[model samples]
Target: MGLVKIRVEGVSKVFGRDPAGALAKVRSGMDKTRLKDETDHVLGLHDIDLSIRTGEIFVIMGLSGSGKSTLIRHFNRLIEPTGGRILFDGDDILAYDAARLQTFRRRKVAMVFQRFALLPHKTVIENVAYGLTLDGVAKPEAFRRAGEQIALVGLTGFETSYPAQLSGGMQQRVGLARALATDAEVLLMDEAFSALDPLIRHDMQMQLKELQGRLGKTIVFITHDLDEALLLGDHIAILKDGTLRQVGTGSEILAAPADDYVARFVRDVNRGRILLCGAFADAGLIAAADAPVIAADATLESTFAAFAGGAAALAVRDWDGRIAGALTPRRVMEALARI
Candidate 1:
């Protein structure tokens, strides 16, 4: 496990004219649904507890009205929690006053939204530097830093273009660059790519993965898409009706769903597509004279691609790229047969 970046401890949110009364009802052993039914108050989230790690893409995924969005807001104190505590590095963020919270938001965390919130009047570089500008950074220094981030997101040439003149994908790049420019420890992304076309969304996913490898920034990405969660998340948390359903890696969630709801949600998932080749590799199989080489973490789907013409066995290579084991054809067959 990595160092814990943010810990949400017993966090809950209720939206109503008398939120305290509704919260009291909830704490007095009333159920989430019953509390809502009996009062005008709405339960946005109920007892959400999670430990988000540093330098990993931690995805919060669920369908609409799952309170996925509401939970994330509490991380940055966008919606003050009706109860419980939010700890950032073991300090209660709920205790932060105006000055302290402002500094925390400006320096420690940055957010990216589904709608690319760019200033139409400002050029790409200008918009990218806007956050630093608000912090009293000089124009030349801010733009210099902004230019570097621009290149990082593959927007070096479009720095002079206005947001309206750019394509939706390019406008999103500006948003990403702006977030990166602050060099914040945590990046809160709320449906950052939901508005893009399929191809563009896929490209952005790949781009985020590549960036994470180099920058190593801890990112909390919100999305309602299961496929997107499976692709991008190092670990995932599933939400439904303001309750956290499950939290685990893609494989763990797929192989062992928590309940009927989760099972139904992942029913159509292709097992072979996500299972690593090492999972199916035979430990007893000694290396042959010329067995094909494969990374231990390589997906079984990619393993199949390696044997497009067909193969009897292949050696499993570890992180150092050494042969750790081999995958016999029969063992691979049984696994693929299930799929």
Candidate 2:
């Protein structure tokens, strides 16, 4: 994990008249249901506190009305908080003037919406270059930068094609490419892959992981899908009824939920696919001389096939290829059972 890039501090949002009064009642132990019933104000978020690290994929997720989208919008100040502060690199963004905020939106953060928000009449390159053009970059320079982003997103040959002619996945790629073209340090993706077919969604997820590995952009991704959250998030934050329930790595949350709501939320997740072998490895155990070696980062699901070879234990190697520990069949079974 890198240093904190975006910090959300005690942020609360209420959608109705007199948000301040509703926030006061909320601070005085009133819940969302009560606030809504009494004041006719909807609690969109309550005291959401988080630290998003530099160059990490921070996922904010929940079911409908969980305030996941509302919370993400706060990062770029799309939705003003009823109270609290939003800081970017230790500077309070809520304090930014209109001109400063506009610059921040253009140069510091870019957003990819759930819908492919591309111009139907514009070609792929034209759409990708839209941000730069809006910022007054010359046509030739903007097109050159946009061309690079188009290729980066694997849309090289589709530069001249309009969005209406492209498939849903391709349109989304154009959206992603557009965000990338701005060279913004942070990318806010609000359910970027939710509209694609299952196979295409999976492909886009993999491509995003690969892109993050290379570009090292700080990405804040919002989703309602647990699988997608686990697959992408370096740190996952779960919300319910506009309140933060828990925040941790996927393995940490799967292994130990903070509350009953979170416990129920992750009850059906495939633990073997999320829990890493390193967490279950026995540092004191000795592996057989001829035991199979597996990477420490390998998921428990991937290690099952190695265990099927009749090895008593598999040697787990760290990134540097040194034996970190040994993982036995019994240990794997115990870990899975605990979850």
TM match of model 2 to true structure: 0.96
Off-target runs (Cα >4 Å) in candidate 2 are 319-322
Per candidate, the number of residue pairs that clash is 0, 0
lDDT of candidate 1 over 93-201, digit per residue (tens): 9999998998888778888889998998999999999989988889999999999999999998888899999989999989999999988989999999999999999
Error of 1 at 183 (Å): 1.2
Model 2 pairs whose backbones collide = none
Pairs of residues at least 3 apart in sequence or in different chains that clash in candidate 1: none
Per-residue lDDT tens digits for candidate 2, residues 1-339, read: 789999999999999989999999999999888888989999999998999999999999999899999998998999999999999999999999999998899889999999988998899999999999988899999999999999999999999999999999999999999999999999999999999999999999999999999999999999999999999999999998888999999999998999999989998999999999888889999898899998988899998898787788999998897898899999999988883
Global local distance difference test of model 1: 0.88
lDDT of all the models against the reference?
0.88, 0.94
Best by lDDT: 2
TM-score of each: 0.91, 0.96
